[model samples]
Target: GDQSWTCFLSADNFKGPIAYYIPETWSKIGKLFNYPFLYGRGLDARPGIMGGGAMEINTVPCFEATDAQGRVYSRIPKLQFPVDAQGRAYLVQDVAYYSKAALYDAVKSWRDGGPACSGRFNENGCFKPKLNTRTTRYSQAGKRIAGVERFFDTRIFEGNVWGLQWFTNDRSETGVFPRYFKDEGEERVVAAEAEVPAETNLLVQNFKLAKQGAPYTSPTVGAWANPGPKLGPFNVKLADGSVVTYSWYRFIDQPSFQQYRWSEEKKAKLQAFVEKLHASWSIDRDYMPPPTRGRLVALDPALLVTPPKGLEVGYVPIVTGQAAQ
Candidate 1:
C-alpha cells in the first residue's frame, strides 16, 4: 500500500485551436463563467469512465453563439480526430443539432469565405474567412443530424495538438511483453507437400531432421521480464509557491509460473523487486509516457507556473497474476 499517484496539468496538455481558444476565450469570459464549479460537477458525474477524464472535457467546450434572430444558444462543441493509413492525424468538427438549411449555409460560408455564422461570436453578424470545410452526417443526441465539420492539418503546431485518442492500456506495453515471447521452442514438420527431384527431396528431409534435433529456444529465460524504467516525480509549483510531486510505474501482469503458487515467498519477492526498482531507476526520454486522448506538454525546467493548492497523491497498484482480475 506504499504506492501513490498524482495528476498534473502542463502547458503541453492543450492541443489544437480549442487548446488555444479555450485559454484565450476563458481569459476574456472565464471570469464570467464558473469553470471550477462546472468542472467539479463534471468530475462528480464521471463521464467517459473508461477514458482519460480531463482530456475528454477539452474536446467539448460549452460554446456560446447568437443566431440571425438575435437568440443566444449554448452547445457543447463536438470534435473528432481521424487518422489515415499513413498515420497522419486530422481534426473534424461536428456541428450538432442545427437545422438542415442552417447547416448548409454554415458549410458554404466556411468554404467560400462569404457571410457566414461565426459560432465563436456572440453577436448576430457573419465573418468572412477562408476554410477547408466539409459536410458530414452523423448521429447525435439520439437523432441523425446534418452538420458542417472543418478539417485542419495538426502537424503545423509545435506543442501538444489535439487529434484522435491514441493512448490506451491495450496499446501500451508498460509492464508487459508480447505474447509471442511467452512460449519456448519451435516445431519442425514436412517442408513441402508436392514431390520434388530425389536430390531436392533428400535435402528437405535432412533440413527437417536438423530442425527437429535443435528446436527453437525462447528469448524469455524466466516467467517474467524486468520492470521497465520508473516514471515521474513530476513537480508542479502552486500559485502560492508551494510544490507538489507525482510519480508512476507500470504494474506487470503476473507470470504463468507464479499463478498457481500463492505463497508468501512469491509475494515477498515481488515486493522486494518493486522496492528495489523504486530506489534505483528513473524513466528516460526514450520511454516517455504514451500519447493519450489528451495532449501532454513537456515542461520547461526554467519557467514554472503556479498550480492550484491541495493536490493529493493518488496510488495506482499495478497488480500481477490471475489474482489481478
Candidate 2:
C-alpha cells in the first residue's frame, strides 16, 4: 500500500509513428465534430536527453467504422493502455503494481477484452471495442503481450511517494501521484515536514535512482543501503525544496509477492537478478534505451534508502514518511 502503480510504454521497437487513440466522444472536440471515430496521433517523441537530435513525430486520427445513419459508434467505451486501432489489447511494457493480485487482474482484464466500457477516463484507462476478434484472443495476443506474467514472479517493492499511498486502497480510480515532489506536504496534510542531518545528501538519496546527474541524484550510491521493516517514513527534501515521504519493502517479503504460484527456482532466480542489478546498475546507468532527448529520471526515486545512524552499507533502509499529526 506504499507506492503508486504506473504504466510506462516505450516506442523504441514500434515500427513507425508512435501513437495512442481515444474515442471522439472523449476528445475535447469529439461532440463538436459529431462522428463515431478515434482521435489519435503519433505522440510527439522528444529526445530522452536534452538536445539529443531531431526525430520523426506523427499525428494521425482514425475513423474506421460508421453506422447506417452515417454516425460512428463514437461513444464506444474508454480503453485501457496498449490498445490498437484494430481493437487489439496489449499489456503494459514497463509497469509497477502494489501487489500480485493487482497485477493479475490487470493482465486478466486485457486477456478478457476488458470491460466493454469501464466508464470514460477511468483508471485502467478505457476499454476498446474488439475490432479484430480473430486476433484479439489471448492465444493470439499472448506472444505480443509477453513478459507481463513474469511480474508475477518478481517481488513487489511498495511505498508511498509524497503521501500518494491512498491509491493503493483508492477504489475510486481518481487518485494520482504528484508530478513534482514539493515541500508542501505540511500544507497538504498528507505528510509533515521533517528534517535529516544538515549534511545528509537528501537530493542524492531522494533522487538516488535518477539517471540525471548533479542537481539530480546519481544512480549509483557509494554502497547499497539496508532494507528492513523498520526502514522509512523518512522525509526527503529535493533540490527544489519539495519534501517527499518514501518507504521501502524487503525484496521478497513485501506483501505483493505473497499470492502466487511461484516456484523456488523462479523466486531464487529473480532474487539473484535483483542482486545483480544492485551490484552493477548505477543510478545513472542506462539499462534501457536512453530517450533520444531530455534528461532521464528515476522510475521511482523512492527505491533508494538512506540508512539511519549506525546502519552499515549492505543494508538498504526502507523509507516512508511520518503522517501529519
lDDT of each: 0.30, 0.29
In TM-score terms, candidate 2 sits at 0.25
lDDT of 1 by residue, 47-111 (tens): 21232112222222232333354433233322334455544453422112222232334434543
- Candidate 2: list runs displaced more than 4 Å: 1-233, 238-247, 261-265, 291-325
Candidate 1 stretches with Cα past 4 Å from truth are: 1-74, 77-141, 150-263, 288-296, 299-325
lDDT of 2 by residue, 80-101 (tens): 2322343222221222222324
Q: Once model 1 is optimally superposed onto the true structure by TM-score, how far is the C-alpha of residue 143 displaced, in angstroms?
A: 3.4
TM-score of each: 0.23, 0.25
